[model samples]
Target: MRELRIRAGYETLGELHRASGVTVATLSRIESGVQIPSPKTLNRLAPFLKVSVEDLLAAAGYLPEKEEDPNEAAARTIEAAISDDPELLEFWQELVKRDDLQLLFKQVKPLTPKSIKKIIKVIKAIEDAEATED
Candidate 1:
């Protein structure tokens, strides 16, 4: 985790703290092996580190590492990418209920992280715009 953060250009704990809002002290403890982050913290940090929460959880030993079905993994990855907040999850779930949206996913069986991030940003921008107009 520490290596990932550093490679992501968060060269110092303070830098990671500023980006993630997870406090330098807590990050310090986690990197030093003195503490393990809870799932929520891992969720908060994963996107900033350009990693998936499942990977982070597996690395932290909170989840077992095992082979996953490619289709299922893609779905989970998309869901995780949109789960930065409750509003995003609500929006994603709504989209999931649409048959047309499911068909789109079938067409793009697998999505890259960059594509997923772009989707997330678009959705978030829409959400923010809606909130302000309300």
Candidate 2:
């Protein structure tokens, strides 16, 4: 965390604190390995540091760093793709909540790689369309 922050040009805890809205004490503790950051803190800091929440969580030992199942990886990839797009993500959340989609997902709980790829493609298409519209 400290190395990444320093690489990102945050020379001091105060600079990180101001940019991340995390307290200097908390940043100090985290950098010193005396304390791990909470999810909220990671979320706030990840963007400023140009890192992903999963990467931060893994580095903090909150999430496993090992390779996950393909389905889980696919889900994470999709989430990462949408993380910067609030409108598209909001639409995705609503679409996921639909009964038809929910039932379809239940029927395919352990998603196949091909299906996951297709889902990602569909989402990308939607996001692209939205961007073009904007």
TM-score of each: 0.49, 0.48
Overall lDDT per candidate, in order of appearance: 0.82, 0.75
- For model 2, residues 1-134, the per-residue Cα lDDT tens digits are 87899888999999988988899999999889898889989999998888899999998889899675654444455556565667656666656545655445434555554555567568668867998999
| Candidate 2 residue spans exceeding 4 A from truth | 66-134
Question: For model 1, how does the per-residue alpha-carbon lDDT over 45-86 read when each residue is reduced to its tens digit?
Answer: 998998899999998998898676665666688887766667
Error at 96, model 2, angstroms: 40
> Which candidate comes out best when scored by lDDT?
1
As a TM-score, model 2 comes out at 0.48
**C-alpha RMSD of each candidate structure in angstroms:** 11.4, 9.6
Model 1 bad stretches (over 4 Å): 67-134
